[model samples]
Target: MTDAHEDHWAAPVAAAALDARVRVPGSKSITNRAYVLAALAGAPTRVRVPLDSRDTRLMLGALASLGARSEETADGFLVHPLGAGGSSHGEPVEVTLGNAGTVARFTPALAALGDSPVLFDGDEAIRRRPIGPLLTALRRLGVRIDDGAGPGRGAPPFTVHGDGGVRGGTVELDSSASSQFLSALLLAGPAFDRGVTVRLVGDAPPSEPHIAMTLDMLHRFGATVEREGAEFHVAPAKLSCPEYVVEPDLSTAAPFVAAAVAAGGTVRVTGWPSTTTQPGDWLRGFLPALGASVRLDEDGLVVTGGSSIPGVDLDLHEVGELTPVVAALLCFADGPSVISGVAHLRGHETDRITALATELSALGADVAETDDGLRITPAPLHGGVFHTYDDHRLVMAAAVLGLRVPGIYVENPATVGKTFPAFVETWTGMLGTGR
Candidate 1:
C-alpha cells in the first residue's frame, strides 16, 4: 500500500540453499504504463512477455472497465482500445486499483475524457498514498475533480468527475517527489485538447530512467513531445498500432544473484537481455561491487559468491529498488557499505531504507539509516526470524540474508505477489535436495 499507515503483517522466510536458475517476471513498469497509453489511444496494441502482477492487472481491469478489451494470446496479451462512446453509458465505473499507483494516477487522468466520471478507489494501502499533485494536475487541465472527502470525504472511494473540458496547458509539478506526476500527464496527452507541457520544479528526479521510459512510450504512441531540460512538451498525437514485447525483470532476479554470492554457491539467472531500458539492469555493476564474482554473458548472468567480499560505497538513485536486495548481500561482506541517492524510498511500500536498516540490525548486522540512504557495517548474522514490512523487496532481501545466516523466518510471505508470487516454490526449484 502507498501510505505506511494502519495494520499490516510481516512475512517470515528463512534462508535456504539457493542454487536455482531463476526466470523472473516481465517488467511491471513497462507493462502498466503501456496498458494505460494503449487503452487511451483506443488502438489495438500487443504487449509481449508482459508481467502479470497485481499492479499491471489493476491497470488492465481499469482499461476494460473504461470500454477497452484485452485477450490472452500466445505468451503475451492483445489489447483492443475503445472509443469515446465506450464508457458513455452513464454507469459509474468502479475501479479497485489494489495498491497499484500507476493505475490510481493515470486511469483517473485518462477517464476524464469520457462523459462518465471515473470513480477511482483502491486497497487500504492505496487509500493512504497521497494524490494531491495528480489532482492538481487534472484540475489544471480543466477537468472537474473532487479531490477530497472535504467535510465528509477522506480516503478511498474518492471520485474524479470530468467536465469534458480537456485543455492543452502547462502544469508546474514537483518531480523531486515522484515521476508518476509527470508520467500521468504524458499518458493523458492524447486526450487533452491543448496538448501538455510539464515543468519539473525540483531536483533531477529520483527515477530518471523511468521518466525516460515514459517519454519513449509517448513517442511510440505517435505523440509529438519535445524535451527541453526539466520541461517536457507534448501535442495531440496519434497513437498508431504498437508492436512491443515487455522486457524481462532484472529487479526480481537481483536476490538470486545476491544469494549466489552470500551462500558461496554458483548460480545463474536467465531471461534478461544484455541490453535494457531499465536502469535496474545496473544490477550487474552493483552486484560485482559487493564482491559477487559476477560474469555477464550475452545471454544472462552468472554469479559465484562465498569468499570475503568487500563492502561498497555507492549512490543508487537510478536503481533504488535494487538497494535492499543488494544491501543484504553487502551485509555478508568484510566491511561497511554506504549507499546513497534514494531519499524517495521513504515513500515506498515501507520506508525501505529505514525498514531495511531496522531489520538488518535486528539480525545482528550493524546498519544505520540516513536521510537519503543507509550505512551498513559488516558483521556475522546469527539466524533469526525476519519481520518483513510486507514489502516484496524486504522479503527478498530477508531471504538473501537468511541464505548467509541460517534460521531466518519471514512474515507476510505473500507480499511477493506484486512481482514474484511463487518465489519459494519456483526459486526453491533450483536449490533442490542436491546441495
Candidate 2:
C-alpha cells in the first residue's frame, strides 16, 4: 500500500452527542453476486439497488469484457447473458480487476466458460493475495488454466482457456483461506454439464455466512443446491434471473454504527434487512456488548452510545471485516480486549492485525499482536498522523478514532472509495461536521 496522496483529513472532533438517521447504499457483496449470476443466466437479469463503487464497477466491467451486455437502469443495472452474439466469443480478453477480490477470484470460473483464453490480472496487492486453491480446483474440474505465478501455483495474473464450457464435477479444496473461492465455483456450477460438488478438506471456512449468501442467491436463481456440513452440491439446472433488490451493506454500515457508540448519541440507519445472511448483521449483538443500547424497530436498527464503552473477549472469524471498527472502539474501552480467531485477516487489503497494532500504538494505545488476534490494553491516546496503508477499512477505523481524540489526521482518506464511494459525504454528514 502506497501513500500517493498529499493532503490528510483532519478527523472531526465531536463536541456533543450526534443524532442522525443514515441511509447507506446497497451491499457490494450482493451486488457483485447479482452481476455474476446475471451474466450466467440464460436471459437478461435486472439488478435493483446495486452498489455503485469501485469494486462493483470492476465486477460489471469484467462481466462486460466477457460478452455480457449491460445497461444502466433507473434503479440499478440490467445484464444480458454471454450468448448475445457479442464480440467476446472466441476472442481472447485481458481484464484488469483493479484490486477487487471478487473480480480477480470469481471471474476466472466465468472466464472458463469463454470460447477462448481469458486473462485475469489485477493491482500489486491482488498479485500478492492467494488464489491457488481456486486454481487447483479448476484444474481438477478439467479446465485448462495457465497459472502465471507458476505451474500449479495460485495468485493472480493468470489466464483461463475455455472450450466455451466447463466439465465441472466433484472437486475438493480447502476454503479456509477464503470462502470466496467456494462461492466462485458455485456461481458457475449450473452452467457445467455435471454441475459441481465442493467438499471442504480442512478447517471450517472462515466466513460460512458468505457461502450461505451465495447458496441463497443460487437457489433464488432456480439452481438446485444441497448442503450437508461443509460439503455443497449444486445440480445442473437453468437459472431463471428475476427482478432482484439488494439489501443495505451491513459491513459498510459499521463505521456509522460505531460513530453513534463512540460519540455518545443515537443513530438510526434505514433499510436494515429483517432476515439476511450478511455477517455484519452480527453487529446488533456486538455493539451492545461494547456498552451500547441497541434496538430494531419499524424505521431501522438504532444504537445509542453509552457513557463508557467496555472491553470484550470475542471470536470474530465470521465477521472479521468488523475487526477494525471493533479494535478502534477497544482503544477507548474501559478495560482490555482480546480479539481472536481472525488470523486470515492478515491477507485482507492489508495485514490488518499488524496495521491495527502499529497504528494504534503510534497513537499511544498499548497493543500486543497475537498469532491469530490482538490483545489491546487501553492507554491515553494523543493526536498523530495515522497512515491508512491504502486499506479502506483502516481509513474508516482511523476516522472513528478521530471522533474522540482531537488532532488526528488520517492519511489516504480517499481509500474508503473502494466499497463506499460516497463515504466522505455520508460520514461527514452523519457526524454533522459538514467538512
Candidate 3:
C-alpha cells in the first residue's frame, strides 16, 4: 500500500520509527504569545526552545516591527524589551506571516499599539481565511483596521492603523470567526495602557483550548487574567520571563495515532513533560476512546493502534484544533461518527467541515457536513489525488487518509509547514519507510 505522492517528499534520511525520543518544538500558539508579551514588556527575557516555524517567524517579525530586539542566545532566544508604552514608527513593515493564526491575531494588536500601520498578510491560502471578528473587535476597541485594502472582503492584503495608539475598554465579539480573536486581544493586552475585558458573543466560541493556551502564556508572562464563563478579564499587566520551553504538540501526535489505528501497530512518542500545559493533552482521554491503546509512561506517550475506533460522537467545542485529526480517524471507525462542537471550523484556514468532507469524499469516504460540524460513515477508500485546500491540518490529516487508503497522492506537500514543519518526514519514519 503506497501513495505516489509519498514519492514527492524527499524521504527523511534517518527514516526509522520516528521512534526517537525527540521533543517537538515549542507550541507555536504559546511561542507566539510568549514572544509578543516579552517584546511588549521589554524586560530581560530568556525564551527557551522558541519555535522556528512560519507562524512563529511572523510573530517574531511583528515584534521587530514594534521595535523589540530579539537575538539568538546560547540556550534559546533572548528578547530585549521595548518596555512599557513602547511605540514604533517606520516604513510600512510588510509582515509575511505564513498562515500562523496566532500571528495574524496578535500582530494586529501589536500594530495598534505602535500607531504604526502595517501591511500584514500571509500564505495565499491563509489570506482567504476570515479575520472579521478580530477586526470588528479591534475597531470597537478603538483601533482602525482596513480589511478591504486587500483584494478580498474581510480578508487579507489588509492594513492596520491605530490613531494615537489604542484606548482599551470593554469590547464584545462574535468570535465564532476564530479563537485567535480572544488570543489576539489577550496577547496584545499588555501593549495597551488599560487592559481589556472581553465578553465573547455567541454560544459557539470555537477552540477554547487554544484560547486557554493564550491565557496560560498571559499568566506566565506575569499578567493576571480571570475567566468566568464566556468572559475574560485582564487588568493592566506585563510579561516577564527568565526561561520558557515549548511543550510537545499533541496535534502533531494525532495523525500518527490515526496511522497506528489504520495499520494495527504500536508506537511510542517521547519528550513530553507530564506537567505539560498544552491543550492537546486532552487527547489522552479522547484518542483512547477512539480505540488506540493509550498509556503515559516515564519517557512519554505510548499508543497501540487496533482495527476499529469506537465511533463515539464527541464534542470538540473545547478543543477544536484536534477536529481534523479526529475527523480522519472517524474514516476508519466501526460505525457512524459525528464530530460536533466546532462549526466555527468553516472560517479556519479553510472551511474544515466542508474541506474534510470534500477531500475525504474524493478518497471515497462517506461523509456529510453540518453548519457546526460533520459526520463520517465507515466506507471504502481508493487511491486518488486529494486536495488539501491549502489548509495545513487538512493536508496532514488527509495524508493519514492517504496512507490508509494506499495509492494516495498529495499535491503541494509543502503545505504541512504551517504547524507541523516536519510532518511528512516524521510520519514516514514512524511507518518504517525511508521515503
Candidate 4:
C-alpha cells in the first residue's frame, strides 16, 4: 500500500537491463462490470479474483447502496442480486461515486430500476467530466432525473427518481465523448420494460472494444444484444452468472511492458488471455512499430527491447486509455511520433492530452498538443516533477519515464490506488529497488 502522507515518489532509475516476470491483478474494467452484472443477475454470483482497487471498492459500495449486498469469500466476492423491480426499501439512497468513471456512469441507470430516490455525487474532477448525454438518454427513456445542468450540460450531484421501472425504447445518443455513455444504458437495458435500442447520432465513440466487452459480458449473463453498424439493441432477459473469473488488466501492464523498451531488456506478463475484448490488447500490434519485439506464447506476453526506439504515426481513437503510457514511451523515441484520433481523452479523469503535453514538456521533451492527439519529438530529457492530475494512468507514464531519466519525481503516487494499489511496490520490485 502506498503511504497516504507521501507527497512525492522518487521514481527509480534502471541501473542495468531488466529481465523480469510480472503478475498483474484482475482487470478493473472486468471487476466492475462483473459487480454490476452480478447485482442485476437472477441469483448470487461469484466474482473470482476481482480487482480490489479503489474503483472496484467504490463499485461494491454503489451496489450495496442499491440494496445488492455482497459477501467476501476466501477467493472472491459472492454478490446478491437486487430485489425484483430493483426496489430499495422506500427510503432515499445516497451514492458516492468518488472518481471512478464506471461508478459515475454505470450506476445511474441501475438506480433507475428502484422505487426510491438515489442521489449521485462524486469528487471535484467528476463534476467536470461529461455525463449529460447519458442523463438525457435516460430521461428520454422515461426515467426521472433532476440535474441542475440543463439540457446537454449534465454533471454530478444529481438525483434519479425511480418509479420501479424504465420505459426503455430506442434513443439517440452522441457517445463520442465517452463510450461509457452507450454502455451505461445497455447494461441496464434488460431490466427495462421494453429493453433498449441505442443509435449513435454523432461521431462514433472511442474505445470500441469496451462496447464489445459490454456485449460479451451481457451475453455471458444471459442477456441478448444485437448490433447493426452504429446501433445496438438489447432484449429483456434475466441475468445470471454462477461464477466469473476476471482476466489480468492489460492496460495496467502497459508501463511494465514499456520498461523493456525504455531500459533494454525483456519483460514477460503472465496469464495473457488468448482472446480478449480489452482495448489494451492493441499493444501487441503497436509496440513493434516503436522498435520492441512483442510475442505472445504459452508462457505469456513477452516484450524484448530493440537496439533503437523509432517513432511512428498511429491512430488510437479506439483505445484512448493507452494514450498516457504510449505518449511517455514516445518521449524517448529516436524520431518524432504523431498520436491521432483521441481527442475524447480530454474528457477523461483530467484533460489527459493537455496534461501529457505539459508534463512531458516539463521534462524537456518537445511535446505539442494537436487538435485530436499529440506530436512528441525526442529531446534531451532531465528529471523533474511529473504531476499525475489525479489520473492513475498518468502515474504509470511517469514510472516509464523514470526508467531512464533519473530524478523524475512523481507527485501523489498514491493516486495509483485507484486501479493498482500495489503499483509502487510492483514497479520498484521489478527494478530490484523495493524493500
**Segments of candidate 3 deviating more than 4 angstroms:** 1-23, 83-90, 148-153, 162-164, 433-435
Which residue pairs clash in candidate 3?
42-81, 42-82, 343-372
Candidate 2: where are CA atoms >4 Å away?
1-5, 433-435
Query: TM per model?
Result: 0.90, 0.97, 0.89, 0.97
Residue-level lDDT tens digits of model 3 in 177-243: 6777888887777656688889988865666677777888788878889889888888877567877
Predictions: Cα RMSD each = 4.2, 2.3, 3.7, 2.1
Q: What is the lDDT of residue 182 in candidate 4?
A: 94
State the displacement of the C-alpha of residue 378, model 2, in Å, after optimal TM-score superposition. 1.0
Error of 2 at 278 (Å): 0.4
Per residue, candidate 2 scores C-alpha lDDT tens digits across 42-141 of 8989999999989999998888888887899999998898766386657688888888888888888887887878888888898877789989998999
Candidate 4, residue 263: the lDDT equals 94
| Best candidate, lDDT | 4
Alpha carbon lDDT at 380, candidate 2: 97
Question: Where does candidate 4 clash, by residue pair?
Answer: none
Q: How many backbone clashes does candidate 1 have?
A: 15
Give the total clashing residue pairs for model 4: 0
Mind giving the per-residue lDDT tens digits that candidate 1 earns over 133-250? 6677667677777646553243456676655538758888776666777888987887788889888886877788788888888887788889998899888766875666777777
